[model samples]
Target: MDERIKEFFSWSDLFDYMVTRQLSHIRGNWELTWDHAAQEYEAEEDSYAELINRLVIELSELDPPLKYHDNEDRLAEYCKANLNWNIHKIGARWVGSDYASILEQGGFRDVNAGDLCLAACGRVKAALDRNQLHFDDMEEFHRKMLADVVAIILYHRSDQCITKLS
Candidate 1:
């Protein structure tokens, strides 16, 4: 791993910003929606502990590495420093099979980080809409968000597959 890349991105911070923070917001919304039966929302932290650890470990091992950011301005600075100007074309490897299906199903392939975040939010909405508030469903929701975060970072910083570990 390049020292520069390591200095710029921290998987733990990104996980906290994207997954943990988002889950907190989602739980708040769930509580508001469920009202009297809010306890049914069951978004236990234990549900995502293993998944988050696995994602961070897997990401840390990627070749050429990727990045994560909690700040838009800082991320933009990193992108400007590292990526080609006016050419945001991402490498093919960033889109996994499931993510590909998601883009295709949505009838669009061109995506920005915001789009990916929205897609992840959609997963949560779907789970809640169906009243599938099980821990398994919440875990899946977090998994999708984490995958999208990986895709977003890899889109900017890597052309290698997520499975291409060093």
Candidate 2:
């Protein structure tokens, strides 16, 4: 295993690298939506999605030598970073809480939960692409789990749990 590849094997390390390199760009370019009641701004529709897409594309296009030498650490890092961004930033921003609370509501978790969950699905899809993990090859149970998670996020968003705060 190449030394570089050995370094990226830990998803946490990759996530840190990605955050250091990319978070500034994401924060700078993202459009802010106004929340009248909160008198604050948040990411606008599809902004998060676009950011994720760009990151995935850029990461995917990197020279294989830089991305990884042998192990799939690059792909795993991509997955974990995407998930962390959605769950920690986008989700928390929208939901005002975490998945546990949202789940206890007896319906959708909340707006944030929905946002994060949807983003998670997108990240998962990107991971599949990066790692060449085939959806077709996944067990039915795994597929269903992914679908359920995505559905919960969509449901939360659809339920209007994410209010304009006005």
Candidate 3:
């Protein structure tokens, strides 16, 4: 990875930032009024716990590890509030054949994980430009960041490539 990219990933709060941004979007879409959306997320916290715990465990296992809250309850609550809740599923699906077409066109089949992350970032940007996926609440920078994280997760999960991790 580029030094700058490595620095970006090394930020202790990068995961928090990404999840917070995602939660904001999810909240906005879940309710018409901001206050109501906020309330809804809070109300749903308890119900989201079981799922969040599973996700946290999964996240801990990823290469290029992320920093998570040390307190289990606090971590789970943060995850629920930020809606990092769905990242595991997102990563899993991305690693599957779901984005194969995009990966193929980007010539990413035999690349290293870092290269795959870069390709995924570009494909995500292209998709946004084509309006294939709407992320009305997120900015271009954020979308790319999220794509990079997902691509990293995909790289860890998939065995389609022979590139060894450095």
Candidate 4:
């Protein structure tokens, strides 16, 4: 963690920042390329994949650091107000997956759990509103969404790969 990483109250604030950043990226990119007329047949853009690309850029530059408030509940409320989608799902695929498969469907398959977690966080940015997401309990989409949320929460709470700028 950078000495400058702006400390937190609970895990909630950092998670909120990650969520907001991911969503902003998704919406900006989608608006640039969206074609409502051909939307049904077009390959759905992967917000997670987009987030990976963004992380790559941020990491290389060591630019913006994570920032959050001093309280958890207040931060959570801020997150809810700013969220593009009410909630996203998560599933096992987020923690583990084959590079070939992720590549086939579109994602940086050759990534670690941390990277995968970020990918999940990224999906939240482009997620459908909770009410709009209509997947059966056993549906694969539902499972993946669930995995994304879980991975994100785990990443936010766990201290791994945290580094400081030299």
| Residue 82 Cα positional deviation in candidate 1, in Å, after optimal superposition | 30
C-alpha lDDT values of all predictions: 0.34, 0.34, 0.33, 0.30
Write down the TM-score of every candidate: 0.24, 0.26, 0.24, 0.20
Candidate 1 overall lDDT versus native: 0.34
- Give every collision pair in model 3: none
Which of the two, 3 or 4, has more TM-score?
3
Question: Which 10-residue span in candidate 2 carries the lowest summed lDDT?
Answer: 66-75
Kindly list the per-residue Cα lDDT of model 1 for residues 44-155, writing each as its tens digit. Answer: 3323333333333333344321222222223333343444223222442222234333432332232433433334334434444566443233455554544454434333
Top-TM-score candidate index: 2
Give a tens-digit lDDT track for model 4, residues 53-124: 233333233322121111112223333345331422243122133322232222222233333334333333
Q: Which of the predicted structures, 2 or 4, would earn the higher lDDT when compared with the native?
A: 2
lDDT of 2 at 60: 37
Model 2: how far is 93 from its true place, Å?
28
lDDT of 2: 0.34
Error of 3 at 30 (Å): 24
Tens digit per residue, CA lDDT, model 2, 34-139: 3345432333442332333233333333333322211222222333354342323352232334432333242322335423333344434444555525333334
